[model samples]
Each structure stands twice: as structure tokens, then as C-alpha cells.
Target: MRRLHTLSAVSMALSGAISGLLLPVAAFAILGESVEGIDSSWVFVVAPLGLAIGVGYGIARYYRFSYELTAETFDVTSGVLSVQSREIPYGRVQNVDVRQKLVHRLFGVAVVSIETAGGGDTEATLNFVAEDEANRVQAEIRRLTAAIEADDGDDTRPAPSTEADTSAGDRTDSAEPRAARELLFELEFRELLLYAGTAIRPGAAIFPLFLLLVLTGDPTSLVPESITELSLVALSAIGIVAWALATSAISAAYTVAGYYDFRLERDGNDFVYERGLIERYSGSIPVEKVQSVTISDTLLQRLFGYASLSVETAGYGPGDSSGSQSTVPFAAESRVYRFAEGIAGVERPQFTSHPAMARRRYLARYAILATLVVAAAFLTAQVIGLERWYFAAVAFAAVPPAAHLKWTHMGYYVGDDHLVIRRGFWRRETTVIPYFRIQTVTTRRSLFQRRLGLASLVVDTASSRTFTGSVPTIENMGLEDARTAHENSRKQLQRTLRDRARDENVGLSPEMA
Candidate 1:
């Protein structure tokens, strides 16, 4: 068994001390001492006690935590009170991630996260291990996983010695040779700048507007009694433009910081990626575990002919907060597709657009939304006696173009081995899901869609839910077409499974077969 780096005690002690200090602070606030002017010198007395207790707890925790990398399992034993132990099998490990914050780097330590299939979060975390030791642990897990796959069905094979050296310092002496690595993609500085410039962060943009409103105070107070109306309008316009520029610069800087010096490489069956500037992350996505591949671009990026490619594996989804799944954060659309093809064996697909009625459906939907907006504006005008409320009618002008873009972008294609679905207008996405990876397929029709003789075909996979909280669906297809696609997907899934089973059987020995 191996212990965490000694430095972890320092970090743990700091955390515990902070937590302990919060207790007295909370008590002081709850007691209303500030209003009553109660004596507070007792806090000084409690502070040292908190620090000592915190240090003691930290040291105990450091000594208590230990882990072992066995032949077929990665075992961890931890917890100060009521110790808990877990053994994670090698074959089930989906991703081994190494993360180093600025502090961790200063301490020459890193956190290693082991993620297993069906585990919503990391299965185990080896916090504050030596950087080199972390890498060794990740590599050993991969080597063991590969070995287990190779030895499947061979129950007679002897397990490696349980007494094997598991110490962090000595394990490397008997470690397997590193796999040959091929440079796959690296983000260029110029492309990184372009990506940052084109990236749209609505949340960040809205924040500045809110801040401006809050800082400016009451809206009516912004107009001074001596100021002319025209000058006030001019000042507002200038402020809005300045706010826009400020928000854009802030968003760009954020993107640059996150994706600085991104690099990706293929090592045997896994693709490894490292990115970030202040807080670095290195993660692996096993090729065989990939559930789907997505090529997406925002409206601005699309106009610039750039897109991003990301893969969804059993361990990481696009929605994962870690954000390590993106293989190529920014590249030319053609180049992105080429890289995606290499990863998932999917070519640039020729999509079939939804039926003409789908276009009518979109037009009707947007028109209804515009009409509702106009009606609400008119009602507000009557209630508040405000002029120029008719300005809301301008939304009608956007309905046609918005509807057209929606129809133009929505399409689907059923390839020989993959099902492709494309949707969205502001941020277009094209997802390719392999038949074998698909978990479910279903068809649905809303009341309006039924009237239009249209239905949606939803495709689900083992990949976790996306950030948008939506499943992969090909919408506004002819009812019959949707049903046909649903049935075909089911049949293809079965065929792919059978082919895989046959290949596995062929590799097995006669006795095991």
C-alpha cells in the first residue's frame, strides 16, 4: 500500500483550520455581538485550540489513508473514524485523470481521480500524490486494464503476486514500458485567439449588464435634473457599447486562460489530453469506450468557419464540469470533421433534411411566439400607460428568418455504423453515435406534430446527459420515416452486438468458448 504525499497534511491542516475558525465566527454573528457590543476576547482563546485540533486531525488523516494497486484491482482504504475500504477492478476503470492546481504544482503533488463505468462521479481520488507517482498510477491502471481485456475468459491464469511492490517510489522499477505516443492535435496560439474572440458567453455578457444596473442604482436617478434628454440618450448608448466591449474582452480572456497550451496525443488505445494554464489537467479517453462524437459551432464560429470536436465516453460527458472531453477546442470545420472521423470511424455525413411540413411547423411556432410577445407588450402599455410599446411588433420581422434557419439546420442521417443527428441554430451541433453504443431508441409525436403528420426520433446512449439537458433527437421527420428510423436503429444495434460477440468468441480458446 502507498500513502499520500506528506505535503497533503499541510493542505488538510489549512482546510481544517479554516473550517474550525468558521464555527466561532458563526457563533459570534448568531449571538448579535456586534449590535450588543458583547465581549469577544474569547475568540482569541478558541483560535489556538481550533488550530491544534485541526493540525492533529490532518496528521491523523494523512497516516490513515493508504491505497494499493493490485494485479486486477485498485484498492483504497481511508477515513479517520469508521474506516472505509473499496476495491475498484481494472477492467471497469474508464478514465484516470491527473489534475494539478497552482498550489499542487508548488508542492510538487497532483490529484489522481479514477473513474469507472456507471460511476456518476470519480470512484476514487488519490489526493496530493507526487506528480510522477500520479502519472505512474494512471499508466499502471491503463496497463492493467489492457491486460485484463487480453486475458478475458482465461480463468486458469495465475494472478500477479499480491506481495508485489506497491510503494510509490519503488513501483516504477517494475512498471511496464510506456506505450508509443503519436501527436494528434495541438491548439495553435493564433487559432486559440480566434477561438476566444468568437466564443459567445451569454452568461458572462449578461453579468456586466446586471452589474452596471446595480452600480448605477435607481434607473431614473441616472438622468440628472440639469442634463438634456438627448445627452442622456447619447450617454446611455456609449455606456452600452463600452459594456459590450468590456464583457467581450473578459470572456476572451477567460477562454484564453482555460485552453492555453492545449495538447492531445494518442497512446495505444487511449487519447490523452493536457490543457489549461494556471490549473493544469491531464486525462485519458479510451477509444473503445467512446459513446459518441460531436462537432459543434456557435453562430459566430460558424461564420468564421471554425468548430470544436468532442468525444463522449462512459466516464466523461460534455456536461462534465471537468471539461476535458473536448479533443479539439477550435479548428477549421473541415479539419474538425477529419479529426472526428479518425476518432469515431464516421465520415462527413450527407444529412437528409426534415420534410417540407417541418419548415411550416417552425414558421408557425415562431410566429406564435412573436404574436404572444406583441400581445403582452400591448397589455403592458394599457396597464402602465406607456408609449412606444408597439416596438415589440419588431419581433415579427425576425420570425421568418429565424424559422428558416431552424429548418435549414435540422437534419438527420442513418449511416451504416453510426446514426447522425444535426440541430440547433445559434449553436449548431452534429452528433455521430455508433450503433453498438446506443442504449435506447424511441419515437414521439406532440399534438401539433401529430396534426402535421410529423414525429421525433430520440436516440440515447450510455453517455451521460448533456449540459443542455437534452437527448439526441431528430425532430420534425415524417411520422412513417421516424418509425422506420426507430426500427432500423434497433436492428442495427442488434447486428453490431452480434458482430462484436462473434469477434470476441473467435479470440477465445476452445475450452472457454
Candidate 2:
């Protein structure tokens, strides 16, 4: 069954590519010869001639395919003329996944994949094995892993309760589809729309809309003439706003059709989500796979106590990672924080504050940058014989003071187990990282910072696996102190993570699995 699906897919891709080339060429060839038009001969005659070759390749690939899988290895053999086979070892297997497309669902079949560790490549799936075979292969690998684990005395820590084990089979972990768990959190059509509208992609409103405004429409009269050569800037701003509006409308229209009816559910600790406009996609995400949890706020969401949540799971694949952090996108802000609290299992979040910067400090930084601009304008005025009159007026136009507004927004929060980064004013953004997740930590001190005896700490999360928990720059801390703190914090965090895994094995695994 799986082989058939693979063959079908290869056939379809090849056929589609060939069809794309041929339709145009075939049309042009007949028309070009008929019209005797100036360029028509080349367009009509030559196009189809080239298209025929592509069509031939597609047909050949569709007809030739074969694959096989066993406990220790899986083999794939396929090609039109030349034959090829590749073998994969059980030790290298990192994950085994099952995917069911609409077409597969019709015949009760699914695509199975064998993912290996330590590579920027894939070597699994002798290309679409039967569902039972896929499950058998997954089981064999699990059985081997479990034996190794049991030899290591891991069986004392019972496996976590998974939605995949509804049926009691001989091999608990192997030879069966882990029950697909509903999402720990999920989103609805309406909420997904709002998220896609405001949060999914950054600068959705201002940047894209601005570009569209320039490309699609034009309006230069919107700027006031007396605003000191701000016409181009004004026109650009107007265009951006218009573009945002148009995209928003387009996004909303998609909301009604694509995800108008959707489902977000989880099984055990893994999440199962489904949504689509044309091609439907659904998958499972394990709890251990979750890398990060993000909560986003728009101006409106802030006031409404609503926010969007996004998570990057360990195995957070294409469709799994796209939704916002929270299963519920519109949850009140406090709810998200509480959920974060629950996920990290921290009751108290520590805080490290900075020396409050007064208006003086802000003006100091702002003025330094502002000085160059002021000098440039002053020199220009003198060169043009406007001297102190026009120059002073332009230089003292309160630009530095206006820029100073941004300075006050810089701050940081360092907790025992997490770091909170703060920057930007009107848009308040915050990020959190667990201590144990830090793969690397570094400290920096600028020339000015050296005078203040201060430094910033940059902690990078471990990216070895796909799960990226957190990364942040913590301020008002020295290199020695930061390193010491991180080391101690990590030791404590490791103990906690291990304890949690144990507790999960004892309490949650059986109940859920």
C-alpha cells in the first residue's frame, strides 16, 4: 500500500512538471505553424518540442518503484532504467512518523517515515510501506530501544502514558501507532485568522502594506507642503497603511474558507492539529519536542487581555509549528503567563533589575547620535548662507528629545531559571528561556559600559535538536557573576528536569499513555 502511494506521488510530480511544460508548447506549436506570425514560429514550434522531453521523464519515473523494511534496517530500490537501494540502521533512527493525506484516508493507508539522528539528510522509508509494516518497523525499533533502556534499568521508570496505546499489544512501544493525542492547546478558525492577521509574520501591517501601496496604488498629495520636505515620506507612509488594509482583508477572506472549520486536539502529551483550505495537513507533536512558547500582543489584544501563543516543539514539523503558542490564541494575558508557569513548573520567577535610567541618560545616548545630524544640517545651512538662522531652527527641532523616548524602554529581567528580555515601547515584547536549555553563555562590555562596571549576558539555547527552548541577552550583570550564576542555575535546573521526567514516568505516563 505504501509503495503504491509513493509510486503515485512520484508519478504525479513528474506528470505535473511534464504537463506544465507540454501544454504551453503543444498549444504554441500548432498556433505558431498556423499563424506564420513573426515570433509565433519559435514560440509555437520550439516550445512543444522541449516540453515533450520533460513529459517522457515523468512517465518513466511513475512506473518504476520498490521498497522494503525490517527490524534493524530498511531498504529502498527504484529508478526507471538504473536501479538503486539504500539501507538504514536501527541505532540511527531518531523518530518514526505516520502521515495520512486525503487520498490515503480514502483507502485506509498512510505514509510512514523513518527519521535518523545526526544529519542534514534523511534516510528512511523504503518509500511508503504498508501501515501495518510501518507500525511494525516503528515497534521493532522501539523494542530494541526498550531492551537497551531496560538493560540500563530504565524500565523501573515506566513509559509515559501516550494516546497511541489504546490497544494493549505485546509490544507496548513498538509495532503500534502511538495513540494520536489531542493538542495540549489548540486554535479555532476565527482565532487562527486573527493570529495569521496580526502575529504569524512580523511587520505584517506596516512593511507589506507600505510596499503594496507603492506598487499597486499612488497618492502623493497626502503630505502637507509646510512639513519641511516630508512629501516622499508622507506618500510612503500612506502607501504602507493602504497595503496593510488590503492584506488584512485578504487574510480575513482566507480565514473564512481555509480554516473556517478546523480542529486542534492533543493526545497524551503530543498535539494533533488539522486545518487547510485545499490540501489538509495533520500531525502529532510530543511534549518533549516543544522548544519554545511565545505569547504575542497587538495593541488591541493588550487592551482586550487576549494574546497569541506559539510553540516550537521538539519534532515540531511543518504544520505542527505554524499555529500560535497557545492552543487558545485569545486567552487573557495572565492565562498565558500562568500556562507558561505551568509548563516550566515554576511557582516563583526571579527578577534582576537595572539601575533606573533617568531622562539624563536617555538624552545622553540620544544626543550623541543626534549630534551628527545636527552638525550636518548646520554645515549645510552655513554653506548655503542660511547660517545660524535656518540651521539652528532645524537643529533644535526636538529630534533628540523625541528619540530619547525609545531609550527608556530598554531593560532586562534575570530569573533563577529564566531570562526575560525587554526592548521597544509601543510594542512591548518579552521572551523567556529556561536555565537548563542554555547551550552557550557569553558576556560583553562596551567602552561606555566598562566605565559603568556593567555588562550584558547572551545565553544561547541548545540547538542540537530541533527543540529551541529560549535565548536572551540579560543586562546589568558582569561576566564572572553571570557565568557563576548560569552554572549554579543550570545545575539546579538539571536536577529539576530529571525529577520531572521521573515524576512523569511515575504519575502521568501510565494515566495518559
Candidate 3:
């Protein structure tokens, strides 16, 4: 279609200037004494050079990048030095997202990201187009795909349809209403505040303390010998408070930046999310493309009756931003469950806990780990001539209780159409994956598990919120129970495939069936 916004050049120039600023610091850090008397003014030269390069590059990129939409395929051609082109068929398009940074918003432009079913990362990104044009493009793609799916009666094929051949000029009228209608959920200001505040990571609280320990090599080293003991205590207290405030402020900004004005809505057959303040983003997944829905809550969230929800789609990867696939970043626990059930197309799954011996196993494992930690702490304290050796015993106090909670929380449910895995100690997560989405299944056992006649059922799907390339698991099931669950999942998968093939008039090979 059209080229990116003209301001793309300025954005590139700013990016280049930032990179240029970092060059001097990096060079100085690396060179140290080697260039002791070098003219630091030369660093100033780098920024202008970078800006020139960026401007030239941006101009070339704008001219070389172009896209064209055909009835069945969307073609994009990009590159300056080495030209690259791709034609993604409507059937192959997995997900489409629109994003806008502060500058782009000010200029009324947005970036559109497209992903495919075959890849974990974005296939193409259309740089800054008019915000309305971006929305029209996203909606048009969904409309064409949906029309193709309906006519073909198949999920994986593009069918010819007169309705899908509309020109870009007609797309605004044809697609905008479908995309903008049907509100499902939107975050209110109060809920947004709770979400931001409670979402402050535990790491943030510990980070300042960790930095102090690393920098000084000992907590007491923070107090200089020349300082009075009372002054030292006061200074330490103030530092802790300051770090706490800094951490809270950082967490709040991060949450607000990523999730401002968050809204989730149903656009035709797709579930769409639009959010962000400075960098607005709109992401969507077809209802059928969703593989699983997960609801999770931290210890604090539980107290506040809040939880977060995320959906797993075939093209999403762990490296993607956490908020990208989030359905509800933070909301009441009850509402989270309601949304999960609707999107996942299943009732809240009933779960069965692992056998009683699993508790003993967890207790044994935690006891040994805690014992080792306490021993290490005691030895360190002794070597440092520290008087807080007894603090190490605190480790022993929490171990058994945490182990008990972990064991109690470990459970799974093989339902009519979905399998649910529930686990985690403090931040509990419950994931519901449909059987049709499962790609593989296996069972594994550690030496200890084997001795205890227990096995872990590992189910895998193309979709994963965890980057480890694995899906939800049923761990520590008795051997017989594991086998039964494995067998049930396989049967359900076959049934789903067969039914799909029958409805689509597609023949599945015996292996697929």
C-alpha cells in the first residue's frame, strides 16, 4: 500500500543518536588506560555521523518498503541493499497486531505486526501507517480470513469469495464496525491502579538489598568507619525506604505504560486487545486459534481478590512480551474465571490431586534442599565472624510448610474437551488446554519417581507461554493414573481431529486420525 509515515526518519535518527551516545561510554569502559588522553570531543562527532546515517537509511527504507493486498494473499516487499519479498496467504496468517508509540500517536500513525502459524516470531511488521489505515488493514485481513474459512468450511484453506475481494477503499466500511463493536472487557481506573500496585514484582523489593550486598560484600560495609553508629543506622533506614519507593515507582510506570486504557473485545470471530499509553498496541487471535487459557494470582493478588489471565495461541512464544497475549492482566478472581471459561470454551475443570505419597516426596526434597542452604549460610556466617548465624535456621522453618503447599496444589484434570494443570506454591497458575490443540504426549520418570511408582505426563502443543517449548504437565501421578490420563488424552486428540476432518470434508491419514 502506502509508504511509512515521513516521521519514521526522525524516529530512526533519534534511535541512532541514542546508540551513538552509548558508544563513548562503552568505548571508555573497555579502553580504560589505553586511551588515557584521547580527545573526548570526538564522541560529539559520532552523534551527527549516526544521525546522518540514520536519516539516509530511513529514506531508503521508506521508499523500498511497500505492500499490496490481493484477494487471497498479502504481499510485502522490503529492503534497500538486498531486496526481500514475502507473500503470506490469508490461510496462513495466524495473528495480527497494531502498535503506536507516543510520537506515532502524535502523528496519527501506528505499526502493524503480522505473524504466521509456522513461526514463533513476527513474520512482517508494517511500519507507521495512519492509525485508521492500520486498523482498517487489521480488520480487512480478519474479514478476508473469516470469509475464506466460512466458505471453505475448513480452517487451513482459503476459499474464493466475492465478499473477500473488496478493495482497500471499501474495507473501512466493511470491517470497521465489526472490529469496533462487541465490547467484552475493559479496565477501569481503580482496577488499573490495583493491578499496577499489586503487580510490583518481588524481585523489585529484593533488588536494592541485593545491590548493596554485592557492592559492599557485606551489609555492615555500607556504614563508613568515620560515621557515627547512630548516623549509620539512620542512613541505612533512609536508603531502604528510598529503594522501596524507587522500586514501587518503577513498577507502577512499567505497568501503566504497558497497559494504559486496556480493552478486550470480540471482533467478528476473533478476541482482540488494545492497550498502552505511550506505545499503543492492538493484538488479536481467532477464537479457534486459542489453544489454552491460564489464570494465575500471586500471594498478594489473592488477598486483593485479583488475578491475571493469558491465552496460548499456536504462534505465540515465551520471548514475546508478557502483556502481548494477556487477556486480563489484572481483574477480580471471579471475573477472571468467567472470562477464562468463555474464551477456552470449557467449564471450570474439576481436578484430582496427586497421591498422598507426593506430599512425602516434596517434604523430603525440600528438607534436603533447606538443610544444604542452612549449612551454607551457617558456614558463611562463621567465616565472616557474623553474629546472625541463628538467622540461617529461618530457612529450616519455612521449608516443610512450603513443601506441603506445593504438594497440595499439584493436581490435574482430564475433562471432556480440555485438560487442566494446576500447580505452583505462592503464585498459583491453573492452565486449561483443549485436547484438539495437543500435538504430542510423553511420560517421564526420575529415579526417585520410578522407585515410588510415579510418572510425569508431559503434554506439548505448538503454543507455549513458557519458552521451554513444553506445555502443561501432570507431575507425580501414580504410574497407573498417568497411563490412564495419557491414554485418555490421546483418544480425545484423535476424536477431535476426526471430527474436524469430517466437518471440513478433509480426509485424515490413519496416523493423523
The candidate that achieves the highest lDDT relative to the unseen native structure = 1
Per-model TM-score versus the true fold: 0.86, 0.60, 0.81
Model 2: per-residue Cα lDDT over 82-192, one tens digit each: 876676654455444555555655554455555554442445443344444445555555455443333454344333223353221122333444454333444555566
User: Which lDDT tens digits does candidate 1 get at residues 154-273?
Assistant: 864334434445444332444233346666778999999999998876667887777768987776576666766456557868888988898899889878888899988776677778
Order the numbered candidates by TM-score, best leading.
1, 3, 2
Return whichever of 1 and 2 wins on TM-score: 1
Q: Which stretches of candidate 2 lie over 4 Å from their true place?
A: 4-52, 60-200, 203-240, 250-262, 277-279, 314-328, 347-350, 356-430, 445-452, 464-471, 475-481, 493-513
- Give per-residue lDDT, candidate 1, residue 88: 96
Per-residue CA lDDT of model 3 for 1-513, tens digit only, reads: 545555665665566556655766567556654767766566577646665666676667767887866778888999889999999987778788888878777777788888887767788887766676677778878877777777745555542223433322222233366435577778888888888887756556777677778888987666576766456557968987899887887787788888989887776677778899878888777776777778888778999889988877777764464448887888888878777766665666678989987887888888898888888978976765545556567777887788889988888998877888988867788888878889888998999999999999998887754422356788899999999999999999989777766653321111210
Instruction: Rank candidates by lDDT, best first.
Output: 1, 3, 2
lDDT of each: 0.80, 0.50, 0.75
Compared with the true structure, the alpha-carbon lDDT of candidate 3 equals 0.75
- The CA-based lDDT of model 2 is what? 0.50
The clash numbers for all candidates, in the given order, read 0, 35, 1
Candidate 3: count of backbone clashes, pairs at least 3 residues apart or interchain: 1
